[model samples]
Target: MTIFLGGRSRADTGNVISMDRFRSGRSVSPIRQAEAYWSALRRHGDVPNRSDIDPRGLENILEYTFILERIAPGVARFRLAGNHLSRIVGMEVRGMPMTALFSAMARAEAAATLEHIFLAPAIAELSLISGTNSRAVSQVEARAILLPLKNDLGEISRALGVLVADGPLGAGGLRFDIAGSNLRKLDIRPDRSPAEPVPGLAEDQAPIRRNAPGLRVVSRED
Candidate 1:
């Protein structure tokens, strides 16, 4: 993959690989490829809708691609997820909240990020580290990118994202350590001015609810 960042092209690393793994023989992270697909669909000024996404265009990175639908303030469920994601979590993850993949302490931050993605309608890139449950030995470093997407009703209530780890995820529960994140508003354009509306609720606030559904593992054949 040839990475073209900062208006320059770097050496082509391999058939399929992310810029982050320039030298590693590991499979491509898919974040970059996914971003390209999203950008291409953004021919109009508005965020692309779930229907705009073409799975075949994402063939190479399809295993790491996913679709999220917002269910409430600061909350989203996996409407569709790929095999690569299921591998990381050790089971089928459809219908699960995005935060279910994060460590206990990092879940609050994850929720905040999700809210930001919808309200601010921004793009989020996160750095993550994961470790095994029993030994606590750090296992892998990962990267994720969330791009805003509009639902069929034209509300920014959906997002397209890709997440990948540097190494294999072995058995047992694996939770990510939130390292850092970067968020960029989708409306930022040098030729235009800020126009998106501010969210009614506070940035860190989560909606109150009773008996929120928990994530469960289910079997599925691809």
Candidate 2:
């Protein structure tokens, strides 16, 4: 498997951290953990307004979750997730344009990742750092990813993101897992779309059933 990591010790090799570790280190998959998050939404018997989600829950998931915004035409409200592969951080991010979260280069990197997600009809993962405000770089490190969520129109609508604050230094393994669930919840927009994302990026070229859970890819003409 392709290795995605922060600063890991050799012991971390072959030792992937599962989602069950949020409280105590346990073996769990991102999707399974998201199952708990979705149950929270189910409890509300509604989409659980962003305001309703507890900040603690968001932070817990964020430690090993994925999230994103749909502010733009192809994005989500503020930040959202598959509920299986990610968790929420501070919705303090509400109303804040994604660009405001990072530097010029960081913004460009974020945009490029977003563009790839749009083009491929798939998800894109990456690590993030808050700002240099912290004298210790490790204190502000945040690893995250951008995932696409679609509306009824068969076009991208909302986005799913996962964020984890890596203290002085992050972990050496993937904290969460990605599977069939996000395959449907996330997509990579082809470079050629109404939004005119960055060009020449190849993305997820598979068809997914959005109304239900679990994801399976079906090849489609690009």
Candidate 3:
């Protein structure tokens, strides 16, 4: 996979480190581990299937990992989330839109980024910063990665992700702004086509389901 570091912009002035540097810095071990696991699952240049994920494979980073289900264009919700994610938002995050963790101004961009991952079937690594007004009140720095996955029907509608933060999570209800992002398109063989647009994929809005005691990997039967 090719890696590119994004340049600092006015909005991301506080983001001094780019994704490439962040990866090399080796501070976010969970992100790296998750990427390695996802990469190892690929066969014949195709994305891994959701059912193929075994919680044991991610035991080390399970608390920082999550699964997402695409529900609409540019929209996805957490199918499962680890404890660290709940701690960040001060609530269980299952069934909540992924953008809920982002600031209002950042949601649009975050949604677009999510869409690109599913539509292009690409892998994305994002640099995030969370604090009051995105200026680091708690001085939290985070790295997140999104790896596409296929559903039981063989459609690219799921994702496996990892989010790790460094610094004191002083308070609950933290929201992050995207500092930088890098995307690598997957190599889909001519025998397999990219995911097609599915109509009526949006589910009815329902209450967030409470998770069990720990991280649970759903099988195809569920």
TM-score of each: 0.70, 0.41, 0.76
Please report, as a residue range, the 10-residue window in candidate 1 with the lowest summed lDDT.
Answer: 1-10
lDDT of each: 0.74, 0.42, 0.82
Q: What TM-score quantifies how close candidate 2 is to the native fold?
A: 0.41
Candidate 3 lDDT by residue in tens digits, 1-222: 543333445455465456654434443788889889988998887899999899999999899999999999889999999999988887899999999889897788788888889988899988888846643356577889999999999999999999987766655678888778777888888555568657789566877667856768899999
- If both were scored by TM-score, which would come out higher, candidate 1 or candidate 3? 3
lDDT of 1 by residue, 1-222 (tens): 111221223443332223354235343448878888898888545678878998898888878888999998878999999887887887889999988888887787788888888987788887677744522344666788889998878888999999876665665356786666666777633336557767885476589666568945567952
Off by over 4 Å in 3: 1-16, 20-27, 131-137, 190-222
Question: Model 2 segments beyond 4 Å from truth?
Answer: 1-69, 73-91, 134-138, 168-222
The better candidate by lDDT, 1 or 2, is: 1
Which numbered prediction scores highest in lDDT against the true structure?
3
| Best-to-worst TM-score order | 3, 1, 2
Error of 1 at 76 (Å): 0.8
Q: Write the per-residue lDDT of candidate 2 for residues 62-163, one digit (tens) a residue.
A: 544434545563333455333322222223445455554445434544554455555555544444444444234243444444445454454554455554
Q: Model 1 scores what on Cα lDDT? A: 0.74
